[model samples]
Target: MCNSVVLGVDIGTSSTKAVALTLDGQILGIATRTHQVDRSHPGRVSMDGEIWWQEFVGLCTELSPHAPGGFAAIGASGMGPTLMLCDAAGRGVAPAALYGVDTRAVEQIRQLEDAFGAEEIYRTGDSYLSTQSVGPKFAWFRQHDPEAYAAARTFHMPASLLVHRLTGAYVLDHQAAGQCSPLYDAARHRWIAERCELVAPGITFPRLAWAGDRAGEVTRTAAAQVPGLRAGAPVTVGTIDAWAEAHSVGATEVGDLMLMYGTTMCLVATQDHRVRHPSMWGSPGLVPGRWTLAGGMGTSGAITAWVRDLLGGSSYDSLTCDAAASGPGARGLLMLPYFDGERTPILDPSARGTICGLTVRHTRGDLFRATLESVGYAVRHHLETFHEAGIVPRRAIAVGGGVRSALSAQLVSDITGLPQQLTRISIGASYGDAHLAAGLLADTPPLSDWNPVVRVIEPRPEPAYDELYRLYRQLYESTRDIQHALAARHSASAGEPLPDHRATATAPERSVTAPERSAPVSPAGPDTPRSPR
Candidate 1:
């Protein structure tokens, strides 16, 4: 069999995508499987952890035909840093708690902050404790479900889970480790033992590696499940989906920013040194020594989806056309795209979506356009935060499904007053995964050769957007109290108590139940296995 092709797969909030690509970045085949997250409880977002592996196997099987010659190496990425508990056999013990979208850890966040001084935590973690943090989520898991906590032998995010199943190497990338906050010390690039014990006692965290580092070879067992992958195929260490998406479009340079338009709108700016702020996330970059400053909106395409479904399931193409005709300012309508709370910049979980200046004259187009523009405003807010932190990204590369909408992509450029480069291949993280996999081989081609910039969307700023942007910021400040009240009311009716940090003190540290082990075995060595043809 030919050994020139590699495979990459990504598990996302709404779908799983697998792509097979030649070493030179020619996409041989792409397969996608759609799924939804569980939002059964208020302020919580989760998904059946088992479904991730299930879809991976299915997608690999379907895409195998295109890779006639077995895949030489494989790479994976996914939506994270999710909290998924696993047993000794690597099976998920419960539904995985998703990232910032899951706001069940507010109380835990306060408890941890009080226990460990907030400033100290931020100083070490390079990020502040928020819904985006995994430490608080671990605390919430231990507090809310002690049984599962005790039963869990290890914890994993989606990508790491796939790696464990594929190569029997339990590992987490440095980029993902930084997102654990408090639990990880970004400066040292290691887990904080005291913080880990306090939040998730006895949990065996995965060994840390960089995103493209080789974790191990695909095991014979994994080979049986995934077609086109031989038992000894190399597999790169996995990372979060957004970072992978950034790499896909060559946005990993120090002065580059990747704006992802997907279930959420994420902005990741590459930096040479650590850059931390109260309103943004600073984490280890895909490779060691490099760092990243990032921000995310809780909703983007999700809002558009909600609008489309609300308008009797109108097609996105039709809705986008209508929104384009609605013009800038969305016909005097303004929106706060905080449908599932927000992340980065204003870290407000209780924030709710609001559309002001709505009248009977407003049509579906107006509503859709306002929804799209709201995300643009949110992107602008993130850019402002970057400026506040003294980071001015020299280049902005756009990727993801939302970028497929000409109107949506254009609105973001116009509102943010930034030109966005579009990549030739837009398969998102899966393509990035394949690129990472290709890097494991010698004589790898440069990113420009794989996926060059195809077009540019330049800003067409308008006076109307400038005015609306000011009101957009003011609208949130003016309605914050009301939004909090509504969120509290909804939680109360749902029989969920919003934790009151005022009355609570520090959370007590817990003891470890599992026996301590020696240092983790590094995945690299001269004897490391290679793919067999």
Candidate 2:
């Protein structure tokens, strides 16, 4: 029975990870595949939905040998509230539009606000119309790609896409549904059919279920395509990767903030009552009777990876070591980590990355340290919003690959003055998915016991960080107009229309093309969806 274990998989922005684990929380094997997002045009980020299933098959195939006894159950997760419209037969109509990072729906957001008063939209959706909301993307499709919208009979996020492929189930978790802003009624915990019809006419909403509930059993056809799993193995209705990561670290209690350090930085603060703010997102928690206030930065580890690549693909360890030596404030360097535009508190899709106070004497180390500190300031901005909303966190838990760097974690702690709790396992959302799968069994152990707090990252006061943060706030305001103008120029040069409702109406007719095939999988492995964790 040692080989009989539950499986968990998460499709993230930059990679896909899978893990096999015993019911008692012992990991048998883990696999990860890193891939890049497609950015053929400015403000557009997407991935082939087919890659999500392909990576799942690859990961399961790689882990199958280690689990000789056979699989017990499966749990799935991915970066979301993404928009992947599909036909009635379940094939993707187009490449999946990623979460907030893809900022092509600005006009759609405004249209929704105008149609449904902003106040009423927030009252129903628990959030304002921001890039993070899925509703605007739906509107964007209807307005821009009428053919695709006409063909789309269903919508799927990464988790639901995998679930449908595995179990032949057409369903989405309630937590994911809540993020569909204006289309979902947070108070009622269900889709608002009227609003759905208004934004995305002629679409069918998937059946809704709790994140941990069993979605369905693996169909015989799916079992044959993927080795080591028999037909009828239970599959849980998985949720957004960040929420699953939150559950993995036992961060579901009121006043517990789960800070995820990954491709993008995300924060999920559990609360007893729903709290609505214009800048942050509010959604139903993984379980009933709980709510979460969430916020995310557009770039975190992504910027560091960019810097590494720019410096001829040096090892991250070397970069971290050099960054540590650069000391606080990065020797008079400050950066705005908005390479993909900003999200949360700022919500500016036109914002571009800015580097201030650069000198020829400064090394790559100083630039890298400034990048890390930039994320720290962003974290502070989000946490300050939480405080203003009267949702101060009693405990802040940090997880993901970025947490491995003491320099980065310390910078966040120093900026926020909040101690960060580190768990024994930091494999990320995949570990959490395994825990959720195990819960379906009657004999599963408590999740808190599965992964315990290994250490606490305490803040060492740094006066320089305070002064730098002040400048960070001012930096964005001072450069807003220039960034907007440059963003417009980039769009024009790319032949991409600026956000305008009339542009789609007046644009020349073009034949609808099928989504392009995903980039060939690298020798190392396959890829998955987008967003922070």
- Please report the candidate that would top lDDT against the real structure: 1
Give per-model TM-scores.
Answer: 0.93, 0.92
Mind giving the per-residue lDDT tens digits that candidate 1 earns over 269-360? 99777776676778889986588888888889999899999999999999888998999998889999999888867888888899999999
lDDT of each: 0.85, 0.84
State the lDDT of candidate 2 residue by residue for 426-519, as single tens digits.
Answer: 9999999998888776466666799999999999988888899999999988997787778888889999866642212211122212111222
The lDDT, on a scale of 0 to 1, for candidate 2 is 0.84
RMSD to the hidden true structure, all candidates: 6.6, 9.1
Regions more than 4 Å wrong, model 2: 1-3, 500-533
Off by over 4 Å in 1: 1-3, 500-533
Residue 523 lDDT in candidate 1: 28
Name the top TM-score candidate: 1
